[model samples]
Target: MRFRRYLDILFVFILFTKTTFAQGNSCTDDSTAGPDDPHSFDKAFDADKGYGYVVYGDLYRFDCCGTVKRWDFSIGDNGKIELQIWRPVDKKGKIFKLIGFNEYTVTNKNRKSGFVTFDVPDKERLSTEEDDVIGWYAPGDSLIEYTDGTSYDGIWKVAHDDNLKVGDSVDFSGGLDQGSRTYGIQATLAPNTAPKFDPMPDKKISMDINVGTTIYTVKVDDADPADVADLKMEMTTKNDFFMFNTQTGDVIVQSTITVPVGGQTVTLDFKVTDHCGAEGTGSLQVQIDYVGDPNTTPTTTKAKTSKTSPKVKTTITDKTTTDVKTTKETKITETSVAPVATDKNTDKNDKTTAKPDLSTDQDPSNGTMSAMTGGSSVDAALIGGIVAGIVGLIIIIVVTVVCVVNKKAKVRPSGKDPEKANNASKDNAKNDAKDKPSPTDKKPPSDSKSTMNGKPHVKDKG
Candidate 1:
């Protein structure tokens, strides 16, 4: 069943004609078809196969599919030839239907002796799948060729009927005549039509397509699959990078392509032969867009960090041959120096003390002094020293507060006997002075004042 569908037509325009710009190799072949080269021998069938009977010496297939343009045969004598063609249905073949038949009067000039031609302008197409029996008989003389060897199955002869039409199935079961023979018969073939490319006339690609990439697999739109190999292609490349793999029809990049600095267009030209005697030309374009190269090495510079440490130096002066003493007030001075520097030479008599490197990153692996280079150990020592100093200060404050409280408790509103308290205070004062550091210690000089009452007093040096 056939159904037709209609659509709402859009605005349409008409194109008059098409003109092809360029072309490639044309489909052109001038050769004869037979079991072997018919020209290689000159022997002819000198005997007649009788009138009113038909014979066929052609039953093999010609692999290259094309159109049978003409018929050729040789005759040594003047005769009449009735050509017959039977279409094959299977390998065994049949004489059921007739597709072609023609009668030709052979004379010395038109159909000559050695080899002659009978043009079949209709150009009956040849099939690669099966063979067409080209049989002919002579009501006067059927001139055949005597080749040295015969085909697998020799020629067959069958009785002819004048009433048989083109579509009538004629029975040849009882009319078979097998013989070792050959015909002067021959035929010429040419391409039926022009072939085209499957993918339009152009292909577009990118510069990013790497080498060895199958850019576009070549394909053709042709009617005959058996004649595909006979179609030749001509490819022209502006860039040597591209090539076609003939065996596989793959267009590949064989090497690198020189791309422009920015976006640009590059093209490769190609052409192929059609099934007919014509050419089909096409082109492939490549678009190159430059980004950046990853092969360039970058330079970098590292920043050097400089560190400083506070340097502390203690000096014993001539005024203090003994240990220095802390009075009511203490003074501190700090000095800073550059980071630790490596020394090739050392002063054996040096007495200066260097502080621990608190910023060192590596674990100490040497002696106990080196162990202090770690940040954790140095921080702990500093915390311990500060705590000890605080404890000593608290003890001094408690002692001073107790002395003041004792002096207040001994007071009796200035009415009790002052001599008893006075004598007890002198005794306490002598004991308190004994607990203090020796006077020989280097203590800052200050004025000392005493009161005549039975109470203690402090002297200010400000």
Candidate 2:
């Protein structure tokens, strides 16, 4: 019986030793496992560094095992434990720790199925510590207490080796420790919000002028008043026309009077832009008056010639002349008168002496006579035929003289005047030769007859 008892004890001892060894091996096997190890846990209870232990509450502990468990105790619940924990060691040992408090208003069981998320603080001041917190819990410790006061203790397994992405979900198990629990807490990754931007609007305005016209058509491009706010236009006239800008691009007739000739209009355009980068434009139209060229009267020129009347005069004279002439004549008649007185008595006595007296009586008689008569007649006539004939002759002579002078002035010698002079000189030389005596006249005087080369010569003198 003693032997059997010893055998049983030894067998029990061997079984116990095997179990302890297997447990210790299991723990040691997962100690070096990474956080992402499928079989290892992500969180655990740390007692030496006091990172995940509650002073008065139950100390929930987690290991590298795949199982999730929780230990409830008053001291573990009261002990201060950081809400967030990270483990860099692959071995199931907690390496990093955070300090924070947790309120207990509800049991750990009621705090399951939700997550704790951190966001930018709304009113909390940032700490200047080396590990300053950029964000805090959204609901804060109060909201965490309101939701459920729970102590978490579980393994926090990294689902992936990559850092937290923009949108990642973390599952929290129901436990209180440095590990993420599926029931106690949960976390959701959200994308950061983008900033708002407001840009100024783009605007442009332009104007064009057409010479000599009051009316103008304005063209606008990409113009919208609502897009471009605060637009103003001012127009001024230069020379003949006024120009200004309106809200829209259009032709506006601003002048009521008729446009003068060669007149121009001035226009101005002002545009503004809105905050949305839109543009608006306007144009001004000016009416100009037309003026015609000045009217001018043409001057006339007249040629004048003075005229004078001829003077005429007439003279008359009257005169009378008297002339007297006288002539005397003598006559003898005595014998006849004496004879009549003595005729009676003497006839008787005279008869006796009558013969003797008759013979002696010689009667002598003489007579003288004169006559006068006067009358005169005169005749006058004009004859200019000879003078007219002489004048015609003189005109003919003048014409002849002019023609002769013209002919003489145009006379020219052939072969130039010098050639003609040379020809004349040649003619004069020939004439001189002809007028010169022959060589015989210069011969020496030889006695009557001269002999040359033994030839005899005879001469006769005259």
Which predicted model would earn the best TM-score? 1
Instruction: List model 2 lDDT by residue over 251-341, tens digit each.
Output: 3433333333555454454453332222344444333334322232223223222222211121112111111111111111112221121
Model 2 Cα shift for residue 409 (angstroms):
14
The C-alpha TM-scores of every prediction are: 0.32, 0.18
lDDT, model 1, position 311: 29
Q: Enumerate residue pairs that collide in model 1.
A: 45-144, 193-276, 195-275
Give the lDDT of residue 285 in candidate 1.
Answer: 67
Candidate 1 TM-score, true structure as reference? 0.32
Q: Write model 1 residue lDDT over 1-462, tens digit each, in one string.
A: 122212111111110111122222222365445544443335656454563333344433333434566667666666777666554432234344565566677777843446667775442343221234556667655564546555554455665565766646665555655565655566665545556766544455555567798877767665544346657776766567688875676888887654555656767677777433445666666665543341322232232221222222222222212211221111121222112222121111111121221121112342211112112323434543443344334434444455457557876556657888789889999999877877654676445544436666576648
Show where candidate 1 strays beyond 4 Å.
1-32, 39-59, 94-96, 110-112, 122-129, 194-462
Model 1 scores a C-alpha lDDT of: 0.49
User: Which runs in model 2 stand beyond 4 Å of their true positions?
Assistant: 1-159, 162-182, 186-195, 198-423, 434-444, 447-460
Worst lDDT run of 10 residues, candidate 1, spans 10-19
